[model samples]
Target: MDCQGQTIEVTEGQSCRDVLSQAASGKTLKKSVACTCGNRLVDLSAPVPRDCSRLEPVLADSEQGLEVLRHSAAHIMAEAVKTLFPRAKVTIGPAIDNGFYYDFDFERSFTPHDLEAIEKQMAESIAADKPFQRKIMSRDEARKFFSQQNETYKLELLDELDEDEVSLYTHNGFTDLCRGPHVPSTGFIQAFKLTSVAGAYWRGDENRPMLQRIYGTAFADRKALKSYLAHLEEAKKRDHRRLGPQLDLFSFSDEVGPGMPIFHPNGALVRTILEDFETKEHLRRGYQLVRGPQLLRRDLWEKSGHYQNYGHNMYFSEIDEQVYGLKPMNCVAHMLIYKSALRSYRDLPIRYFELGTVHRHEKSGVLHGLLRVRQFTQDDAHIICRPEQLQDEITGIITFVQDVMNIFGFAFELELSTRPEKSIGSDQDWDRATTALHQALDSMGLPYAINAGDGAFYGPKIDVKLKDALDRTWQCATIQCDFTLPHRFDLSYIGSDGEKHRPVMVHRTILGAIERFMGVLIEHYAGALPTWLSPVQAILVTVTEAQNDFARQCASELHQAGIRVQTDLRNEKLGFKVREAQLAKIPYILVIGDREVQDRGVNVRFRNKEQAGTKSLSEAIEMINEDCQEPFKRGGMRYSFSN
Candidate 1:
């Protein structure tokens, strides 16, 4: 017998089932192994392995298995929907990140009440424990069968398929055109939740009939599902849209169009502080900051493969009868800078960094406040290096990612994405790039998943995902090694051998996007930014108009000391001002009442809690400066005080 093109010896006249059993006992060490007998996927219990070569059992926790479970859950959901709403017509059901969604071409939009009812039906379907049965049929047979059942959406799907024979999955009297290896029964879906409802187009085409898409998430167990739900609740509470406004940080206007965020003065204060810190950090790391235009000629993108591979996601305009595209990436311009001058092997590992704003067309349905936006800034960098120096460059990037994320108190996991199916350049080049990434990860002693066929078309990549306080994972950084881009752009450097050779290019980002990171930070800190990063670190107030001068002086001193200070010299009473500041979550409240003003001191009040005693002018500055320098999680600013 031959499996995956390898020969295996089996006893003559042995039953196929027996042969498969033996094969399962001696399965290969590969991660995702799927066995096909005569090009047909089957379970190990099937009796076709005797005549089959290349038969092996797939790993249970492989990506393939997870997809199978998600897809199966979608089918179970559809079956439940049909059981509940007999008139609903199922269109499409597919697996997405950690979940599955099924769309139906129904007459009315599904309401929250409908979702609750559908969820109840789904629970009952799981309890019924119906089997997921697969059937094979010719294309004509499938089209005729679905047509007779008034499943126009299924008929449309069948028409689009190019295969001679189609596979159909059935569960509890409901059938769908599918190529699947589902869980044996509905009982396997122990945990699931109906998330939301939205309108979507058939086949994602605007011209097609609109469908009501029901989003949902499922997990292997009830505990896992509950954990996910809890994370979702936390995410909503941390949502920057709600917190940003309540905290008086940012706003969006209909006049400015959707997806473009406007930072208020307070928001700018926070962003300015972050940018200043990052600028200093980048300079210290030997990076030269550069700026580029917001839009460039489309021809440049063509050379960089952005036009070919990602043009559809870019915003384009016609100027002077020529196409100009808003920058979707910062790399091409950096490449042009490197090529502007002649270089030798001596200038081998040149690194250029940019906090560049880029524009990409994200679907409106997918856009959420700051997380998914059409325009955002990236903390991007490009490293041009020699092949021999690739590993060290990658190591440096890993360290950079670690340092930056550690500042936010996040622990991250890494994954290496290998070559994708729709890739450019030669196989040898891809192999080398992939090997270098694997070697880097191995040398760092970091455990990571090898995500096969998930890399960019140009090369392999290492993705960093951070776990939040709620145990939710968010991808925050990526390091990509590209050999094809150099070849495509004819980027070259003089070798030590005095000949031109393509330099290996590494694209790395510490923070994937600033807006998304800010959103994450809002949730991570629960809208209470640290003293060093807060929009308004302190609020100063006077007991009456008599002490307004003292309050103004206090605010000015803190501002000069690089602390964001706001003075509440409003005509309101001191208690009212203190209450307002506390409600705004300000870290510090300095009150200059008549007693403290006469004594040349200020009363200190902490937000969300009772007050500390008064301090002199010099004393207050010294304390605030110390607390701002090294903030902590103790609610109020951390200070170094002597007894």
Candidate 2:
């Protein structure tokens, strides 16, 4: 077959390395980590097949090669663990997005010291440069081999395999059951570090025995690994769980039940500001604000196919012998509202928006502060439009998401999710809905990845993942197209032909969940929110008791100008008050002193400790008001104290 416009033929016994070496005509192969024969990735040592059409090298720094390197590092880690604890049973070890993890069942939990010792052993093994050997054996032989060693987890895994033969990889004395195309030797692991250890139930089942999962990361070289570790350090500093309480944002209480956060006064103020912004924006976009009940009849959920597709993640109760479920989504209520009235062709596109609170039964292990909670508020909206107007409606939602994300200073990527296995819609319906979403994305020249079989049960969706300051992606916004919901709810509108036609439904959220979005926002800005979003935009501090009255007057004027201002008239030092205001991340500190009272102006200090000099009361108010404008209307201008 042709490769790089060259015709090359190879015999069966020749390895990929030999073939590539011949094809290269004496060029070095040090940069090549692996080779792909057709669609399958294989090690350089693997024999070339006669049927191979084209062969290409996988570079060490490429995405696929990084995965291979990480997987190999995981095996090396397992070997090191086995060396330290012979009785430890290794389960599955897979490469994840930024790293890799290996689960092991030991008599006791592994400690920080154990991790260090394991790392030492891994380094030693890598220095030895032991080759990884792969072997295939009959299922019975593999079972007997693992059973003899009393590796019960491996034995159990072997029992579940339907294949008559299985593959095993061995490095020096350690062996593991895996289907792999790992690096040639342990020495290939040039840079790696074990990050942490956590408890995970076997196969994620709580009833099963708990296993100690060790997480680690590997990169092509030391520089990349060092950069990643630095980023991780920054991420820890920006952790919302710690910053939330430090900044008096939100809290969780044992008595209040897990996964339910109690937003303190400051937190509530931020929430209210965000909700108010959402309301004004929605109204400006021609959306009507609406509210729905917290719970609905179980039959309604069943009819919507949620009971069958998402019941495991739902909470249910029996009321008056009729079962009911807490709303895990806002679609049902919006659909009910749409069905409550008939619509004419002129009203084909009716948008309803809600800051709706929803509850879902999340496992205790997965509940992370506000990021993953049982009860949270969602900026939910549903738009019902004619089939002919589906594409335009979807396009409008995409534009809306871009505008909102820009206001938050977030960069986002989009993904199109197709129908899942348990989805209820007809193939034709799914196809049409998926086409409309694609058309919208394509029309805007937006590039999106496809997440196959991961859509909501009733519809296809576009997931918008926002990137924060730490460069981590959070799934915040979504636009879903549902043909089945209207059909299930029997929702329709009169067409120009005077005939009733089923109106298509589009489910969307600009900020998907208020709790989660706030958490991301807190971490994104490191608790120093923009002036417009800050709970207290400014604080008034009087230099002396003599200036207290003037400080209060200044605060009142600022408040009247729509700034969230508060005055500190306590008998505290001016420096102390400034420090406190800065600690609270207040955007501006207005200092009123004898000189300022005489001049009828105030000295302004920003949260970043930059002084804005003295400004007359009216000038200060005007500058503050300009900074307080919502970011969307301000053309995506970010917060700057200098401004």
In the range 1-643, model 2's lDDT, one tens digit per residue, is 5554567787768888877876654433665667888899988788876788898777668898998889989999999999999989999999899889999999998999999999999999999999888899999999999998888999989999999999999996899999888888888888999999988888887778889999999998899999999999888888999989988989999999999999998899889888887887788889999899998999999999889989999999999999999999998998888888778989879999999999998877678999999999999999999888999999988888888888888999999999988889799999999999999999999999999999988999999999998889999999999999899889988888999889899999999999999999999998999888888888989988999888888877887777888889989988999999998899989899999999999998899999999999898887777776656464543332211
Per-residue lDDT of candidate 1, residues 473-545 (tens digit): 8887999999988888788899889999889999888878888888787877888776668777788888789
* TM-scores of all predicted structures: 0.80, 0.94
lDDT of each: 0.80, 0.89
Candidate with the greatest lDDT versus the true structure: 2
Total backbone collisions, model 1 = 4
Q: For candidate 1, what's the RMSD?
A: 6.6
CA lDDT of 324 in candidate 2? 95
